[model samples]
Target: MLRYYGVDLLDHHRGTLSARRVWVLLKHLPRDSAFARELHGEESAWGLGEHLLASVIDHLAIGNWLFTSAHTAEGESPPDPPVPVPRPGVADEEDETPAASAGEQDLAWFFADL
Candidate 1:
C-alpha cells in the first residue's frame, strides 16, 4: 500500500527545502533504517509527516533519482544513478505564454513580444 500522501508544497521554501533535506538524509541512511524511522516520527525535524516523507521518497525513486533498499533486509544493492524520465515535451517556442493584450501599457507589456 502507498504510505505517504497529501504533501503540501505551499510555503515554497519550507516544502522544497524539506524535500531536499530528506533526500540527503536518505543518501546517508539506509532505507527503513532505525535512524530514518526515528526522524519520520519527529515531524519538526524533517518538517513533514510520516505519509509525506513516504510520498516524497516514492516520487524521487520513481523518477530514479533516489534509491532505497528498504524492501530487503540485506541492503545489498548500491544506489543507481538517476534515469531520465521520458516526457511528452512541447517545443519551447510553441509553449511560450501568449503575449499580453495591446491595451496594457506597462514596461513589461511593451517588452513582452521581445
Candidate 2:
C-alpha cells in the first residue's frame, strides 16, 4: 500500500498539488522539523475535503515533531487559496482522443520495432 497508494500523501495533497508538488512543499518545510511535520500533516488530514487539502498540509508538524500554531497570537489570518490549475499527470487517462485503429496495431507501422 505504501508503494502503490500514498493515502497520507494523497490526503494532504490531492488537489492542490501532486507528488512532485509535495516535494516542493517538503522543501519549504522547516528543515529541522520536516519529517515529523510532513508525516503529521499527512496523517492529521485524513478524510479532509479536497479543497482544504493544501491548508492542512501547510500545518505540518515538521521533522522535529513540533506542532504548528495556527494562531500565532499576532492575529495572522488563515493562508490564501491555492492556484486553480492542476499539475501534469496521466493526461492520457483523461484523454478523449481516439485510440489507434485495430489495423494500425497489426500494420507495419505498429510492428516496425518488433
The most accurate candidate by lDDT is: 1
Per-structure clash totals for the candidates: 1, 7
RMSD of each: 20.2, 20.2
Q: Give the TM-score of candidate 1.
A: 0.16
lDDT of each: 0.42, 0.40
lDDT of 2 at 58: 46
Each model's TM-score, in the order given?
0.16, 0.19
Q: Could you tell me which 10 consecutive residues in candidate 1 have the lowest summed lDDT?
A: 83-92
Superposition error at 108 for model 1 (Å): 67
Encode model 2's per-residue lDDT on 58-102: one tens digit a residue: 444231123234544557654444333232221344676443334
Candidate 1 residue pairs in backbone clash: 4-51
Regions more than 4 Å wrong, model 1: 1-48, 65-114
